[model samples]
Target: MSLPDPPAPIVHPAEYAFGDQVASAEEHLVGQVDQLLRTRFGKPVEAHLAAPTATDFAALRRWYGERAKGWQPLPDVEGAAKAGRGQGFGFSHGDQAFVMVWLTRDAAEGANPVTILRYGKAG
Candidate 1:
């Protein structure tokens, strides 16, 4: 699904687990998230298939997560699991997207999990 030129705010910050992606509870708007618009879909939401493949993850990291405009990080920021870092791919269903992500059961209080995509060295 295509997001707005400036993606709408965390209207629904609640994410659920599927295989395609991971999310953190503490959500914040990372710079450049607006630039990255389109990400490939592994299977349609209707299919309810397994998560993305390793190859897909690599591409997303290289493109959606690190290289391209990069991942926006979440379905619902408020609902994410607490504190830590993880990675994954984008899985879009209509207006919603559930990305691939690695998750640890728990983390430090207020730590707030989030994904860190690649960035160019500051000039």
Candidate 2:
């Protein structure tokens, strides 16, 4: 059977933090994350599947815990999951910041998804 068409790209409004700015600001952040992934990993990421469950977050925390200390979960923002797609990927930018993204499950399995992006101090 043919696969369903992927959902249209949705950047959850609540998660985006550009106050009174145009949508392009959020788009720009996504673009920066994309660029960082491509340059650092030497490949393109296609989607970021959502992980909205405690189990999902726990697994992610475990993984991060392996690499560093003081790892903390980002708060769940409205619409961040985007149809229940979960947070799937993350990286650190030097010693200053950590970035995470959520992806659709299909995208997580088949490709890359940079759906939800959040960054905070690296610890």
Candidate 3:
């Protein structure tokens, strides 16, 4: 007997939206993300001049987390918005997770863009 085919990927709407935004925002966004996005995801990334709104950033973060190979919990934010600070998810692309990072329109500034994030491989 013949074997069955593999299942298709579950591409969520939010994931697609984020990809579109990233693509529209930059031509080599993937390269840029691969270079620096890693640092922002799990740390307090510095704010930029043209950073996106906190909500948008959080949305994108969630999307990233969904595809994460591994995720970790973080402390709760004492004052700032829940999305802005506190625990975050982590994932590994290959051998290393690098440094999960995210940038807003105002990331150039000294604003804390990074959060309590974690990354690794899932069992």
The Cα local distance difference test for each model comes to 0.30, 0.38, 0.32
Which wins on lDDT, candidate 2 or candidate 3? 2
lDDT of 2 by residue, 1-123 (tens): 111112323332334332333234344445555454444334332323323222244455455546645443333321333323333334343433244544323332433333433332311
- Alpha-carbon deviation at 36 in model 2, angstroms: 19
How many pairs collide in each candidate, listed in order? Answer: 15, 15, 37
Tens-digit lDDT string for candidate 1 (1-123): 232211112122254342223332212222123124224322222111123222233443344433223335444322332222333344233344544333333333212223332222210
Local accuracy of candidate 3 as per-residue lDDT tens digits, 36-78: 4344343322211222343354564556555543433222221
Ranking 1 against 3 by lDDT, winner: 3
Q: Would you estimate the TM-scores of all the predictions?
A: 0.21, 0.30, 0.26
Candidate 1 residue 106 Cα shift, in angstroms, is 24
Model 3 weakest lDDT span, ten residues long = 1-10
